[model samples]
Target: MADRVGEQLGNYRLVRLLGQGGFAEVYLGEHIYLGTAAAIKVLYAKLASDDFEHFRKEARTIARLVHPHIVRVLDYGIEGTTPFLVVDYAPNGTLRTRHPKGVPVPLPTVVSYVTQIAEALQYAHDQKVIHRDVKPENVLFGRRNEVLLSDFGIALVAMTSNYRSTQGMQDMAGTIAYMAPEQIQAQAETASDQYSLAVVTYELLSGARPFQGAFTEVAVKHTLVPPPSLREKLPMISADVEAVEMKALAKDPKQRFVDVQTFAAALEEASRNASSRTTFLGDIPVSQEQGASFSPETIVLSQQEAQEVSPTALFTTPDVAQQPSTDELLADKPATAAMITPAFEQKEAVEAVEAVNTPVLKEKETTALTSQPPHKGISRRAVLVGLAGAAIVGVVGGGIALLTHPLGSQTAIQPGNVPPGTNGGTLYTFRGHSGWVWSVGWSPNGARIASGSGDATAQVWDATSGGHLIVYSGHSDSVYGVAWSPDRKRVASGGFDKTVQIWDATFGDHYYTYHGHSGWVWAVAWSPGGKHVASAGQDTTVQVWDSANGRHANTYRGHSGFVHAVAWSPDGKRIASASSDGTVQVWDAVTGVRLYTYEPYFTDIWSVAWSPDGKRIASASDDKTVQVWDALDGSHLYIYTGHTDFVYAVAWSPDGKYIASAGDDKTVQVWSAIDGTLVYTYRGHTAGVRSVGWAPDGKRITSGSWDETVQVWKME
Candidate 1:
């Protein structure tokens, strides 16, 4: 069908196309009356023509299989010749966009995906629904990076439209790479889903699918192949975990685990029982090209080949058990992926399609990132919804081309004013760190900026000139936090080393180290008067110490989980600490007594900030929002809902009128401090934005990102 950018179908108005596949197209839709957003998947007319009623019944099953981890179908209808199902909109994009193809996701993140998706699959299985297709593109991220299982029953309805009782192996349906052997033989049961999930887990852990090559070869391997050992490819994975994965990937449905949940539980147990020597994060490598995707097109076998390949021929590749040698299959490569008729054309990364111009941050000549105009072909109607970030780059087969080197002249001139729009402009990008930049801060005098990186060091650089200045390499691991002393004479940085170290601002010499927290320090902050410093992290406590000496002042033990972010009230009398316990606790700065436990959200708090006047607190959360509430009574104020993924960092603009929030969505958004209306979105970074800080002069904002760069952008 042609583009229906503004067409109304049932209760939803099709705003813009989100993603398209060989069998269906997903559109960003808005509820006509309530303005609630949804993903409207429109199946081609020809496919829908034959099974319109079956499709509706399947839609009912999908809508009622409601679980926290499963996408709920809200409505279904036939618009003219096309049939569409409106489901819960996940603005954060799909896992294929986030993990890419050739990259290994952090082990912890992959396990989380398994846990949630397993529960969803178990729930669907209990209801007698076997999701024929289970892959990264079918798994989407909800508002706060929560894994959501989508395409539930979509394959069963669409691909099986021509289902005939006589059709068995000749009429199989699914993305071939993840398809179970039973599914390839048209014997899809709950166990088939289990096998598919195991394939996904293996792919996630080892960064490559076990089966590769043409659709026919991949399908045959599902029948005969004994998957390669997961530990052999990723030694970081323990043997127990490998066993669990192998059990799930068994070629015979009965040979697999009893259920997907059991498989997930076993994997979790193995991960928890990891040996003392096991390391989850091995290299922290960047994203690379993914292998050939599973296209929905049919697999054809020649007449003689089909007759010759009976059940007996399935094991002729290697041993009766092994399909092919591991060396040949695991050779990092693109396995003739179905780029042409992809079920859904996967993007390079989940570069969120801007729902309100998920705008970019321009590099102002000398910076690491420069701002650019929005891409020409992006849907303007996409802005009708509020769950996506502005698009930085379009779909590219070669992968994202990032700009990390110096782009403009290296002359230092203090930038004055640059006109600001919904998409903020980049002023400069500071480069030098050899790893992901985790934290960034503006100096008290506004002349310099401080950045902490996974390179195991913290550096101070000129804010405008992008000139390198101070480099503090005292940390033994990745530095997660960095802060400037109020007096501008010193800096405090901390991270995997578990010690908060203070150093001279000019000479990068160590001052005194604070060992109050017995954990990796995640955040560090300096008091306004320049007398005290606050550091919090995995210890689940916020520790305060004197900047002059390493003497401890007060230790706040109010949080029940890891403390991610900490901010001092403007009056300096109170401190707010956000934690994984789903609460932001405020306490008396000196006494360490609790003032209030703000529970506006029931998820992880990634960042927190205090307004300039100290009366309100703004927190970034896994709930995909920046919530502002009363600082004293903890009364709810308002939430900024522009972001589509986990909101990582939030900062109050110096003048206090605006707030800047950044997160996994890879955009730095500036919005109203009072009502939470988005003012500008800075899509400067190519990776998740981890840290944001406003310049003392209020004309600039600095943000750190996983792309391993710190970007400074103009506020004006």
Candidate 2:
């Protein structure tokens, strides 16, 4: 089809051509009256004069599937024997736009996207509709960032078999990279879509398609060879996850999961069971530590062998007449009208006035198909919550289930008894890290946050906008701890690299490296005066050093095992360290003298926090409790038994009225500082909560998690 810009068909005027594919020419279109924009997919196939009604009839069946995820077929018709389908315009482009080819998406995000796509496919299957082309290019995004599955127009031909050749239904109809074995044989069914989705999942996780090479090689591999293990690409991925992927990628359609929904749910269950610390993906699922690449566009094959076919091979054959040489304006009457209404349509009257609401589609062309992941149905809650204790049942029908699934009924927190006045929910998420975000600290001004991740990088980013400011990648291994200076100008981060690094918060310039720890450095804290930094490590020591120079001031070897955390008292006169020695040791800051040790319980302590008033101390312990005690006498006060697993992080509110604790249960709970009763329990992270900090304004909090995200939420 030639460039059809300036052509008017029904209510739409083709504005600019967006992309040219082997199947259709997609143009950015504007409605004449409503002024709404759409992607006008003008397909170039010579529909015989008598076959026009059959084309319209098959198109109507596809249009009837009105779903949030499925791209809407706003209207379709033939203009002088040319078939064109109008659909919703996705301004944000596709998933390929956000995360390009071979890019590593976070595991949590991958599961969520696949879940949304599965829901859409399940719904379409109910309508007996099978999308022949489920590749990335056909997945689009709406203006609201909703996943809109496109190109069901291909399904029209696949189901009705009108546009196929004399070889019968053996004509290849989809992108070769994601085609299932059955699809290669022209036997595409609903189960075949599930297989293709598994290929997509495999690509998303391992950053490469299961079968790669030329079309012929890939087609043969898809038929005979088994997919490479995802574990080979990402060793950190759990065996259960790899097994689920393999089951879905089975060469035989009958060996695969019953549907797309079951495969997605099984993947989710496997991901949760894997260690959040590993799945947080600091070690991305890439075969190599390099950038991304693209995929093949379209491939057509005969029943026996592969062959090149033009976009109009099915229509331009001898049975059909060639289209007119020059383009022609649409007829006054539409080829389809009142009789071809949508099946489950809900007209968005407000959405019709979006001519100026979105940026015009950029005039760009690509040979490869784009990608779009479905976004609705899978929310932050759904990502974190799955109340299946023993197993996650994918379906009551024939589906797969995991015996020891990570998704299960979580413990509920009782009503909090703390001071009331904070609005609490997730406000923003820091998603730059590829693996687990182990530590996070709010800047003194509450405007930014510093995070350390398993990606061996410490980053500074805006707390509200989630914008990156700086990424300090000097660490040689996973960065386990990070803290901002009191002035908010510098940061200190220590990790498995066994050294404490000081750097400029604004530009990520390295200032000093304290090479005093023999083992992994797990925690770092700045003094109230900002002159000294205290670093705790697996070497069983708390080393206080000069922040400006790589000079150590004191080494407090006060524990029998590794020191997990360190905190400076508000007065800066004392340092408190929590250790695997099963104690919270409070000692003098200047001298390596231990003042007192709080060991009321025989469990290891992971985190220690000083009260804002410097009158008390709190410690998170491995016994699933947060212990609060007197800073002066080390007398036990009250214990919070809220978490169902080991408590990892603890922080006091700026006002000293409330305390927050994060635990392996994947929750950040706020409680009364006076009596240790629950105030609020935040269940937004999909993995274990590793670190917690309060904003200087006292209205918000930031928590790092094994889910590889730093979530900032408002509490007032």
**What tens digits encode model 2's per-residue C-alpha lDDT throughout 212-331?**
532333454465444555666666767667667766766556556767887788788777877564745642435533222211111112212111322112211111122211112112
What C-alpha lDDT does candidate 1 achieve relative to the native structure? 0.68
The total of clashing pairs for model 2 equals 16
Q: What would the per-residue lDDT of candidate 1 be over residues 71-158, giving only the tens digit for each residue?
A: 8888887766566788888989888888767667666777789999999999989998878778888899999888899877456545
- Model 2 is weakest, by summed lDDT over 10 consecutive residues, at 344-353
| After superposition, candidate 2 runs with Cα above 4 Å error | 1-424
lDDT of 2 at 200: 80
